[model samples]
Target: MSQKITWKDKLDFILFGWIINWAFPQYYRPKYHYTRYRKILLINVIPQKILGINRFVKWPVHFTSVIHSPEKITKGILCDPGDNPGIYIQANNGIIFGNNVGIGTGTKIISANHNKEEHSKHDTTSPIIIGNDVFIYANSVVLPGVKIGDNVVIGAGSIVTKDIPANSVAVGNPCKVIKHNPPHREKFTREEFNKNIPKQYHHYFDISSHE
Candidate 1:
């Protein structure tokens, strides 16, 4: 069971980022591009300032978060990370997002999870739960009570209407996990991926004299 975040939670998240974005930009390096600075201004810093919640972020105007709407939402969350501008969330008692969620351009997440027994669910609303390290590509829409598991990748233009397990890759209109990225495997870290090897090591990696 995830928690429903409040307006204060939004402010707290944005305000706390200043030490990283403003004072110390190195620790919390922007994973995307520099344009994120302006996005932070528009979505996180600006909205709170206008609404008179709290304005702690200033300078460089960086954003690692997007719109977090709590109005009429009963449970869960609406997390739109990455460079996307906004998220329009509607739910009665459900919605959640894991850390480092990359929602592509123009994505919509429905809060309401459906109940099959309710034949009258023409306009029903439920909750949506997303796991950690989930990447949702562009124009993806997630319906209610859909539990997107950790380390999952939702392909672009997908319409997710069911529960997705962890370490999986899902795609299509009714998204399904086609690829499963098993956990606990020894994988390359960013540092490992970018490791600069000595010329002697060329034979070890695919420097391909083989090619």
Candidate 2:
């Protein structure tokens, strides 16, 4: 037998939809959309947003993760960087993330290196550029000014000190590329890359300004 929709059910649906629209502006057509709302209502969104915990992070994130200079960090559509616990992002210089990037639990991305001459000062450099469809696994550390290329998989517990080329699977303390898994991945210029990201995900613009 089919259950009839009551007025209360309609109200609940409308309220949930409103919350989702307000909170996640870039999440247009999120997968399993209704279920995501249920999870947000039950598990993730309340304490972090309402209790003033992780108040500066605009995205839906795990309460245990920390983000410094969130204004300097940029990400693509539906790319929730610190959704996993124990994740740390220090974007004092800047950190640019491409589309569909996944950051695992305990991962740390530090964008500014400390000066060799002065321990109190940070050395200036370009932003840590992470390319599209990249998966930085659990406990991995991406050091300052490192550029990870597109379609790359960084293994668990790896420390990335240098730039990694595209379509590679990298692992180890120094984070060397072991193999190029997808040889046929497409290449994109910096302009094209930036263009590929949705306007809602841009660091310069406020999420609410899109609508």
Candidate 3:
């Protein structure tokens, strides 16, 4: 059975949670998991609001992240673009992320480049399109106009300058496909999915906390 919401919880919601919820309107919707909503209120919204970090952005992103032109970025459900600490996302041109996309710590995704002729001007050509189930690991830099296909894994410290084909694992200074992998089509059960997630982050997806 799910744990009941006690009066203390209600009081907390009334006094503290609701204020944070009202301030950060994005996660207040019903579609978010109840546990996720509460965690975002406690861990993200309240602290960031108090510290004035990421005060302009309305999403549950980490305070240490730097994002430009949030309106130009497209995200999917369960997608936390620029949620990881030290992430830098510049979506001035645009950035389209598919479902279950993971941008690792210190990763930088920039969708516009400085004009060669005019250094002060930006060259906005196209959006960086990242497909479903893609994971770009730590300290990687994804440049403008790169289309990373589905089920792609980019290794740490890579500099992506071109389109990465589907089901490929790429790495290095100039990121290139090192190996080809099979398409990820196998759906996992709830238990299986939970097992893949680290124990420390378990509270974010606590199924038992559903109300």
Candidate 4:
């Protein structure tokens, strides 16, 4: 930790942390959410993203988890970075991933999709968004200008290029919805199923429950 600290350098640790918290999440989150709505995920990250490194008491701890620069993630937000390791957003606009998003191994998001014509692409880029509970399989590429709705499952080795509906299962290049998840619950009736439960003998089939 001492090697990372010096008097000559700006060592306003607490102040820098507050700045990171107040500014970075706010800046990136908005654009990230918007890009999702627009179905243009995979865009280069916006700018000035803060992961609260300034809030850390130990320099070594903070440095280990830090991602890339602000310019790369101009205005994007990725909650639960602990689970989504090696995840990076590179977009010109916004890229947002909702909570509980299970992105499988070796997934790469390339958000910056510009016009093939170099002249027209100079100032144009798209975005990408993955909703909550969305499961992206391994080795998947989610391109720019794409949106994956909630409860969606992306097949492994698929390339997503379009907008997916909520509760849908999509697979293949330029992914398409193969199935939609329906609301489901499990239940057992007394006639054929309740007998399996020991009733008053044990409420949960456990001797302790009778007590």
Q: Estimate every model's Cα lDDT from 0 to 1.
A: 0.52, 0.74, 0.73, 0.47
lDDT of 3: 0.73
Q: Which candidate, 2 or 4, has the higher lDDT?
A: 2
Task: List all candidate RMSDs to the true structure.
Answer: 13.4, 8.1, 8.3, 17.2
Poorest 10 consecutive residues by lDDT, candidate 2: 186-195
Residue 52 deviation, candidate 1, in Å? 8.3
In angstroms, how far off is 168's CA in candidate 1?
A: 0.5
* Candidate with the greatest TM-score versus the true structure: 2
What digit string (tens of lDDT, one per residue) describes model 4 on residues 1-211? 1123344223332334334333323322222111231111111121212344423211111222233322433221223331233444344555666544556656666666556677555344555677755678877888877888766789998888888988888999878888877532222222322012223322222233212
Order of quality (lDDT):
2, 3, 1, 4
> On residues 1-211, what C-alpha lDDT tens digit does candidate 1 reach at each position?
3346556545544555443344322122222222333455465555545544323322121243233344433221122332354434444555655444567776777765456688555345446777755678878888866888767889998999999998888999899889876542222212231123334333322323111
Give the 10-residue window scoring lowest on summed lDDT in candidate 4.
37-46
Residue pairs that clash (backbone atoms under 3 angstroms), model 2? none
For residue 21, give model 2's deviation from the true position in Å.
Answer: 2.7
For candidate 2, write residues 39-142 as lDDT tens digits.
66544567566776666676777788888888898877647778788999999999999776789999999998789999999999889999866899999999
Query: lDDT score of model 1?
Result: 0.52
lDDT, candidate 4, at 153: 85
Q: Which segments of model 2 are wrong by more than 4 Å? A: 1-15, 27-29, 33-35, 183-211
